[model samples]
Target: MIETDAAGKIMFARRALFAVLFLVTMVGSLCLAALALSPGGFGIFDVVVLGLFAITLPWMVAGFCNALIGFVIMRFSADPVAAVLPAVELVRDDDPVTASTAILLCVRNELPERTIRNLAPMLEGLCASGYAERFHLYLLSDTGDAELAIGEEAFFSELIATWGDRIAISYRRRTVNSGFKAGNIRDFCERWGNRHEFAITLDADSFMPADAIIRLVQIMQVDPKLGILQGLIVGLPSTSLFARIFQFGMRLGMRSYTIGSAWWQGDCGPYWGHNAILRLKPFTEHCQLPLLARDGEIERHILSHDQIEAALMRAAGYHVRVLPREDLGWEDNPPTLLEFMRRDLRWCQGNMQYWRLVTLPNLTLVSRYQLVLAILMFIGSPAWVGLLGLATAALALCDDPADVMRSDIGSVLLLWILVMWFSPKIAGALDVLLAREERRAFGGAGRFIVNFAIETGYSIILCPILWISHTIFLFGRLFHRDINWMVQIRDDHAVPFELALRDLWPQTLVGCLSLGLVMYSQPWALPYILLLAGGPACAAPFATVTAWALLGGLAARTGIGRLPEETAAPEHLLDLALPAIKSASRPPLTSSV
Candidate 1:
């Protein structure tokens, strides 16, 4: 009890420190925003601009804090992972596998062949390690498409024939994915939750080795209070340039960001829906979805259930933790820019639903704060795009540029915002460069630095491109247009220009108009606007080029954005034969994309 109390106090102190730093950064940004907009007088336009800027600042501030803290812990701590998560010390190699676990793979119109391909190795590893008996495989599918269901049924038969004897394998499909993934899992909890002490959830794209799985189960066995334990889900190495470069940047920023977040967040860490282990009984009982009233009916469900589930689990007095390390878990990223936007929009829709649960009872303050942050993650897009529109209006309306805009303050604010926006990735790069082993793991300093630069440019262009998509979708959401939660294409493929144009025409139009107005009004500010606007203007070409087979093939062959897995292929990943890893290595196989 005393140790627990001390841990709680330590966690409180960390949060308090984070709050102070976050407030300082936000307040400073607001001051700069005010100075940049209203040097002469604070008009209605300036007030609105400030309001939008305020709305948009928290996400950036939180990112900056998480990145900065994560970087410090990563660089200074002797054993970074163990320092953040002391439970690491409890999991010894010989920790007995006493608890029964359910390997739950949820499918929704996904390719059964791909699912089996990913599952085969995991099953073999489990059997080889002699843990197969303790783990049962559940194919929790919600395939509404009849044709897809046929394929799934056939594949499940084959899957059963091959490995059902070694490890218990079962397949269950719902005609409709009523609650989507959360609903699918809820069904599992009702039918089979009692059978397993813990459940390891896997998305169609997600893959975990037997060792990672056993390690997680062991961690949970030791920590009775631990409800959910999430490992860092690295992107499976790809031949697609889009996934490769995108994940490289994500890899850099994610390490420090997650480490810092895990340090402060402690037990109340994030559960990213998949690539995680969950205690079955408590999750079933305490984490029930609250009735969402949409247009005066309790028919709606929470789209983004992981964060809320974490909050609920914490409220139930259980620790929701994340293991801040890579190589333990892997997932396939959207192979093209267009596919990325589609997936992002679904998340955008789901996260926007957090407004309904932000006030749920018994949740810790930090839990509620996380919900708010999740909402802001997507909502802030409108504010950012609003600020852009407001700036364009301010520029066009003013006879003199100095009337509504101050270039000196504006430039500083721009630089500051960019720094914060990219702070995590920058902090990550610094962490790698500072460490000899990490740098070498990323194919030495030269290759790592080159990858970092390319990823940086890719990110700058990608942010606004996604932001515009978010902006448009959020507005449509206001009018009751919702995105369909469909199966995402996991494999790499070429994105044709015509298809790119069809999807990104709105971004292109908005970009061109916004830039043209800024250029004609204030020609000098063209460069500044280009950072955000250039992306939207060239969204089509950007999408097409990023998905080009030849370019992607060349990048994979040349190790342009080589990850650790590509540099030194892991034992388990060798089987997958990831294009990038295979190209870089003598024979084999990763990042977050």
Candidate 2:
């Protein structure tokens, strides 16, 4: 018995060492790949391998690090820890003097009028709060097109004129959209950051209850070390079936991960660009625009600038926190499957950019690992595909089937992959029911099943689309292609089937290839292959089906089976969507299209 126990311990230690060694090798491979990017470059295959190695290493590291951090914090920390609200100390609202806050809403070309109108309720909620006197609203527009800019300006002006001092309103339009959102915010800081002690940054489509913003600011005042506080963003369901599923997944399953992440890291967790409050001085002074070496090509405006900026602040010894989604900040999600993919592809490019960061100097091991983990999450789909491909190829070429099975090794590897893939969702689901404020969003087991059906199905479809899109984005960077940073363009209406077919064809191709390969190489793997294939192949049908069901449900509820009406929106959301009100002679905000 003693000997068996000793053997088990030895095996565990060996696996740990293997994991570490594998990571070190990955780091080395990335360094070589990056080094190959000099004037004298390597061949296409070499560049591709190097690029993949470099981009993927961080994700691998981040997962390991997140687990390790969870262990340490859970074991060592003496604080009341929840990922969303870490160390929730009882804060007294002593500041009866409603501190004035400038809610900075950054927007591009979209339905400015509709988005602004939707956010009216939230803004009204803020005004209803005693601190209404202290909260000022700023509509920052980056809409560059003449017609859209004109439309936005008029819409914003009317909104402000209509509101008439319920909230002090200001607007700015950037002439050239530099640095995406980060640059837009930086520009604001340079022009007027000093005007306010703190700024609440929001996406054009995002909204938070007035109290959440007020409370966040009050908490910031209490903690001097904090630089940025990220609020949990709940997804708002829309008419589209795709939107409904994503909203549920994000609100329930995904929210927990953000909460767990925030709880584990507290201030170390990076700032999400939207639905967050930030200290102006640190962001402007410390979060300088990253100079792009290839200018419009590689490293253009730091693709994931928000994460990078948060990393920079943390490295500089400032705190960045993830606040609980329980506070009620909601965001407009991508309404269609295609729109979701387009947005994710951009994210893939930015996440891949983190590889350049891991090699930079002065980062803590924890932060470096965090960047790596994020990278992994982005690239995991392709990596899984590639890994599966390699295993099949190896088995096909080899004579001994038993040798190929290598059941112990394959089983462990497969298990780890599954855990990494599904843990976030499971973690999130757990967090949803646990958080008092968010629990109401999710019902009992019935809602859980519905949410799962939508998320699992939608995520599967998105996998292949993103895998290809990210591959192209990464390939562009490797070959040094010029890439522009743009805000995710949001549309309220569903896209036509023709557009859906156009976007889905590539995913269909890869998924088909994967299915063919799995059948030929390992017939026993049929069930898994079909399971994965169902996501991509049936994506359109699934969405259509889901949408039909939702419509039917809505019809059953309302006497006239018409489309459901949009709920009253928050005011901060309106401020974000309304066109950039042109101040005295500045540049016009650019349109997203």
Instruction: Encode model 2's per-residue lDDT on 352-385: one tens digit a residue.
Output: 7788788666665557767877777766656545
Question: How do all models score by TM-score?
Answer: 0.96, 0.76
> lDDT per prediction?
0.88, 0.60
Clashing pairs in model 1? 235-591, 582-588
TM-score of 1: 0.96
Compose the digit string of candidate 1's lDDT tens values, residues 517-568. 9889888878888887888889999999999889999888877778888878
Q: For each predicted model, how many residue pairs clash, with residues at least 3 apart or on different chains?
A: 2, 27
lDDT (C-alpha) at residue 142 in model 1: 90
lDDT for predicted candidate 2 compared with the true structure: 0.60
